[model samples]
Target: MVTGTLDRKQERIIAGIPPVSDFSGIYFYTINNKSNHELVMLLDSIIGLNDSVLSDWLNITPRTYRNYKQNTDVVLKGNVKEHIVLLLSLYKHGVEVFGNTADFEHWLTEKNRLLDNEAPYSFLTTVSGIKFIDNRLTALEYGENV
Candidate 1:
């Protein structure tokens, strides 16, 4: 869960409509049939990733990715849903650490020597990669430089 005054763009990264009164409230990452738009927004708008790249990450064809965008009622399941959840979790942690979205995005794209000179964002295409990045984020959250 996360708490913050998210703008419209930030809202796109979330799985559901946040509480109106408490702008800064915890957000749980649970995507379902109804939240397909959110996933699309996260990948296209927030992450600035193209459909082809996103499709590749999800191990789906570009045509399927297009279908997902065109069909509002499309429901994501299995590994694709799991991967989106992982990405949202990583973004949440990055925001917490950087205190802003831009800085976090920069950090994500910047090569890190600790990660064997690979940009953190480059490791987001696999489950193992997600775990590795999450571990690094946790370490940073706990004041570990690495």
Candidate 2:
């Protein structure tokens, strides 16, 4: 597997998240109850990565990389920021993973194993663990207020 280096800040971010992806109640447990730190732990778990791989990705020392992660917990939890960081983590390793990316729907449709017509809705909803867009959802054009 390919490994990279990270500055201290990046290392801290990866070190922050827990490594579990099977939890069905990740969001409800974190957001509704303000357990953002718990979510940070989960993001850190992605691909079982380390500071070295991340350092190379960031082109900095491990120290700086880790510091950013320690502070980026909240943004990581909201799926607003730190996504590229997360993606870079996986991408550098040649691993495929998912987040709240805008391409989520399309990616799920084409690659994610569908449970036989139970989807375009339920599957994604379940995978995302969010109930915002019910059954009647459609992909919006770019910048169309998704």
Candidate 3:
């Protein structure tokens, strides 16, 4: 089973989805209630990723990100929404493992031998890559050396 330190609301948000073993299942939980402003806040507040990285992950331009932040009514769709859910889920696991946001963010950007000297953040752009990172994080949680 997928384990983490997520609160009841976060757990409820992801309850419909399958466990993290099927990492792609995370995309099935759409962000229906949240506006763009909420998502942006979550990204900044939880994951601590910057605007440039978020823009790249969402496949949106920097200007669009600013516009979304400026317009509270704007809602995200398509890849942007999917990426946000994925990141939020990952952030939960990361916090559970690392114990704090700063440590998780550092681990994300730091090169790891298990990942062939690549930072975990490099995998955030694609579904398959996110799955691989999730698998690695699961392994780490279970005391697997790699």
Order the candidates by TM-score, highest first: 3, 1, 2
Task: Answer with 1 or 3, whichever has the higher TM-score.
Answer: 3
Q: Write the per-residue lDDT of candidate 2 for residues 16-129, one digit (tens) a residue.
A: 432223233333333343434433343344434466544433344667546645764543334422333333232222222223333443433343233344433233212232
Candidate lDDT scores, in order, read: 0.66, 0.36, 0.68
Worst 10 residues of 2 by lDDT: 130-139
Q: Give the worst 10-residue stretch by lDDT in candidate 1.
A: 18-27
Candidate 2 steric clashes: 34
Off by over 4 Å in 1: 1-34
Q: Sort by lDDT, best first.
A: 3, 1, 2
Which regions of candidate 2 are displaced past 4 Å? 1-43, 72-146
TM-scores, one per candidate: 0.70, 0.26, 0.77
Query: Residue by residue across 28-70, what tens digits does model 3's lDDT show?
Result: 5553445456656556555566788877766788788878777
TM-score quality measure for candidate 3 = 0.77
Q: Let me know the TM-score candidate 2 reaches against the reference structure.
A: 0.26
Stretches off by above 4 angstroms in model 3 are 1-28, 31-34
